[model samples]
Target: MEQIVQAECCGKTITISTGKIAKQASGAVMIKSGDTMVLVTAVAMKTAKEGQGFFPLTVNYQEKAYAGGRIPGSFFKREGRPSDNETLTCRLIDRPIRPLFPEGFLNDTQVMATVVSADKDNDPAILSMIGASAALMVSDCPFAGPIAGVKVGRVDGKFVANPTAEELEKSDLEIVIAASQEAILMVEGSAAEVSEDDLLEAIFFGHAAVQPILAAQLELAKKVGNPKRDIPAPVVNEALKARVAALAKEGMKQAVRIKTKVERHLAIDAIRDEAIAALVPEFEGSEKEVKGFIEDLEYDLVREHIIKDGERIDGRDTKTIRAIATEVGLLPRAHGSALFTRGETQSIVAATLGTSVDEQRIDSLYGDSRKKFMLHYNFPPYSVGETSFRLAPGRREIGHGMLAERALQQVLPKHDDFPYTIRIVSDITESNGSSSMATVCGGALSMMDAGIPIKAPVAGIAMGLIKEGDDFAILSDILGDEDHLGDMDFKVAGTAEGVTALQMDIKIGGVTREIMAAALAQAKDGRIHILGEMAKSIAAPRADLSAFAPRITTI
Candidate 1:
């Protein structure tokens, strides 16, 4: 049986049809808005790879240049590798659905989301997530889904569900959230610094509004879902687990007792190296696997101790932030510069105010677009205490930069309020964790240093979660290792009164509301603490732009 469902989203009619396209795929769907359409397909490999512990699911989101009646910009005039935007969109599609799959089903799976057509006013990221979920539900992939996503915006403190591109121009919040029928799976966006309560309200509203879409997917799945394939559960050797656990126990205990970020990391690395060497004699055939398992176990133990025992790796309480230092006008020649360091993560954010002529004009499938504010994030090799090639910003850097950009967009002065085209560059000098949030803090201070007179000061904090069965701990201002080992990364940005932006990603099955509430509460405490540190250096934006920066006059 084939089915098609239609509804109004962001003032446009959105239609979804399954069993009509890519019929051979386990599950497939076509989503359309006006003439712009997207075909999403999902397929899982017949067999799981032996000894492959990680889920081998891959998501590819492609934007055809021809979709918008344009040729590729490159000299080849053909699409090649995925652009940064496309890669991030693929990641967005991957994050929400990946967790919804059943654990232990490690079959090779692929989800392809292609924008066959695109309307200039509608963004394809949220729709792609929707299509991906629809396809998985209808496929034999064993997805615990019927998940749906929406882009929420804020204008004059009112929340708008699935706002169009034009509406986003006037909105302070550009939030994308993916949710199952019961809980949110993924959230990423930028906000102006909205209150904590408002942020939670927006999440609830988005969840409620997307429920109908989830219902539609479930209905389609019932009609066309394929018979799920059987895959063996991932096996863990009992002996290997026990041996490695013993090796890491004491070292992990010492690592967690340290007080500073750098010191703790050094101790952990030494412990891991020693454990790997000691385990080589016990497991000759699977030495590599044994070491990897040990490291993961060490992380798990650290997180459990933090949550259950009320202890952190860096010895901070659950609500405590790392030490913070702020300095303005750090660079003599820069228009406006500020260096903000929270624990070991440091960002030197510089602001360059320009006239309307300096605004960036971007040509894309959506057509010509002008952006008045641009935020660029750079991560050099030395930032992480490593040495590597000096190339262009990779997808991670670009994605992180964009996240920070969105976080700060909520508080930027409007064209009517201040006519300058603002560009902020965050140079990460050191990174242990959450450089993007540091970019937000530093960008705010830099704009103030440059005298942009922004509406309000914005701050951001990264929250981490460690879950063991029913026991869970929410850590505010988590370190890099905690992020890697934790189950969830929840970032919130906002003003003292409300939230401006929120983004959440989970590694395991979607988190319950109880965990989300805890994360939000912890984030607020960390955000306020960070804002207090920022206030000590500068309380508000300056009254005049830097002489070096271009001046713009509004009519």
Candidate 2:
């Protein structure tokens, strides 16, 4: 039987149907808005592979050339590797849904969204996100979601849901929000220096807009949903856990307060080795389980210290930002260069100027276009004090670079005013946490050093959260360890006047409006403090471009 559900969203009708196509998939749905259509499917292995230590979920979002009535222009006459747009969209769809899976379920799962048709007025990325959740809801896989996504824009002081491309052009704020019926799950987008209040309102508006879509998914699932598989409970050896905790309690307490990343890690490792060696014979063939128990004890201890004692691993308060230092013109031969260091993290960013001929030409479903600005981020193994075969840029690097790029995009001069093509390369020499934010600060300083007439300087900061039932604490400028054990990782970037870009992901179900408001307030203070420190080096754009830059003249 075919099931279809329709909802009116922002005066436009959205249609979602199942059982008519991709019948062999575990679960599949076809979603359409305007003339744009996306087919989303979810499939998972029935059993976990042996020795699988982590959940293996992969998401792919692909755009077909024929969707927009175009042919492939490559030599092979076929679509090639995933483009930057596709990769970014994949991350957009993955972040919110990844956490909704039930713990202890280690099956190899994959979700794919393909754009089957395209229209001039509608964007398929948002539609793809909705379809993903709907597909997962009806599938047999164990999922804690039936979430939905919406794009919010403010045009002429009015909030618009799922705004068209033309409306977005006239809008000052653009944000994509994903949420469950109860609270917001993920947020990612850029704005034109919107205030904290305005941004918070936009988020709530988006949350309300997605309610109808969520209802439609539930209705569809009621009609044709399959029985979900049961997730097995993880086994716990109480005796072993008690033994490990007793031996390592004192050592773990002191280890977390070592104040340095390298020293702290070393101390923890020593404790782990001693415990494992001492208990290997008694708890035969369960070294991994013993290791897990020790880690859990450490996690609980650290969270207790922060919540009850109001102390962090580095002895800072919940709202204190780390020390910052900045320098410009570090590379003489380069067009412009800056070194930005915050606490233990650092980025060396360089900017280069080029002519129109150097603009990156992108071939897409909508046709060809050129980009005047590009930001590239690189993370070598040595940054974390490890060694491995250095490869090309991976998904992490691309994602971080695009985030920093969006943060700076709000302040760039118009193409007509500054015709030179600009490129920024951010090399992270050291990283403990918030390396992407370091890139944001360095990129801004580098561009200004190159004499590019940007509208304003930009800075970024990453925030974390630790919640225990009714008690919760929002942290500012979190370190690497806090991010690992916390419940949320939220990043905010912008100038002193307002926020330009925001990204958030949470490990819990979702966050309340009150929590989000507090996090945003704390994040704004941290961002402003970072900007003040950045201003000590260079406050404005240089008086002239580098002598090596190409001179531009109207033809």
Candidate 3:
């Protein structure tokens, strides 16, 4: 039996159904908004894998070539690995719901969102997000979520929910906001010189618009949703946790305050070893619990100091920017190059100039589209003082590159003004925190180094939050530790005048608009300071490009 439900949203019909297709999946749902449609499935193993420390939640978003009436243009005549767009869409779906699952219920869950139909007017990214949430709601998994996503645009001072692809091109703001009925989970977007107040208003409006779609999904789940699984909670020896904490408490407390990452890591490991040697004889079969307890203790201590005492791990003020260095035209043969370093995070970005014949042609459901301006970000393990094999770019690399690209897209010259194709590559040589923001600063300098007439120099900064009960603190230019332990990862990019790109991911239920306003204001100040440092190296585009750069004489 097929159960279907519909809702009116943003001047369009949003239809959702289940039980008609993908019945083999543990849970499946089809979601439609405008002419765009997506089929999402939720599945999980009956039991978790042994010794799996992290919850394995995979969200795969695919665009079938046939969705937009196209065929595979590759030699294999089939879909290969996930494309950049697909990977980014996957991250969008993964960020909001990953934190909503029951603790210790890691049963190898996977949520797959396949775009079966694309209208080219409405993006399938948001539809995929909604569909994945609905599928999880109907599944037997212990997912504590019923989230929905929306795309909001600002046109002529009015907010438009689920704006069309055309309207987005003309609009000054392009934001995607995903939320539960009570709280927001994720936010990603780029805008013009919009104020903090207007941005908050747009977000609130988008939240109100998503209620209808969420309501429709809930009604559909009620008709065909399965009974949640009955799995017993894992046994934890409370005595083991207490003993381990008592043994390692002082050592970890001292380790947490170490300024450098390497020293802190080594110190924590030593404490763990000492505790294990002392207690392993008594607690023979409780390795996992002992280790988990120690980690939890460390997390609590670090979070407490930040929220209560305002003591950052690096011993810096909450709003202080890290030491920065920026330089341009380092590569002699390349068209343009710039090396940007802020504290430990660094990137050597290079710009390549080409002709119309060199543009990258993307063949997807949206048909063959050519991108004249592109950015690629690469991160090698060696850059992070580690050892690992290298392969194709992963989700993090793709997401970061896309973010830096969005940050620079607003400042690039129009197609008619700059007829040549441009591409920038950011090679991370070192990373500690906000390498994505480093890429943005590096990309801007590289373009200017190549004599690209960008409207203004763009820079980025990452902001973090530490929230405990009613208390909270926002940290600007956060270190990697703060980002890992903090409640929010808020990244903002723009010129000195205003913001051009913004992304926020929260681990808690949500944050108030007041916090967002404060973060945005702080980010602006940090961005201006970074740009001032960048101006010292090269303030604007050069008179001419490199002598060895590609020359394309337009006829």
The candidate maximizing lDDT is: 2
Ranking, lDDT, top scorer first: 2, 3, 1
The residue ranges of model 1 lying beyond 4 angstroms of the native Cα positions read 1-14, 23-26, 47-53, 69-84, 102-108, 120-122, 154-160, 165-172, 260-266, 551-555
The lDDT of model 3 is 0.88
lDDT of 1 by residue, 74-110 (tens): 7798888886689889888988888777778878899
Ranking, TM-score, top scorer first? 2, 3, 1
> TM-score, each model?
0.90, 0.98, 0.96
lDDT of each: 0.82, 0.93, 0.88
Evaluated against the true structure, the overall lDDT of model 2 is 0.93
Q: Write the per-residue lDDT of candidate 3 for residues 238-279, one digit (tens) a residue.
A: 888889888998888889999887788889888888877888
Model 1, residue 3: C-alpha shift (Å): 5.6
Considering lDDT, which of the candidate structures 1 and 3 is the better prediction for this target?
Answer: 3
Name the weakest run of 10 consecutive residues (lDDT summed) in model 1. Answer: 225-234
In terms of TM-score, the best-performing candidate is 2
Model 2, position 82, has a per-residue lDDT of 93
Error of 3 at 84 (Å): 1.2
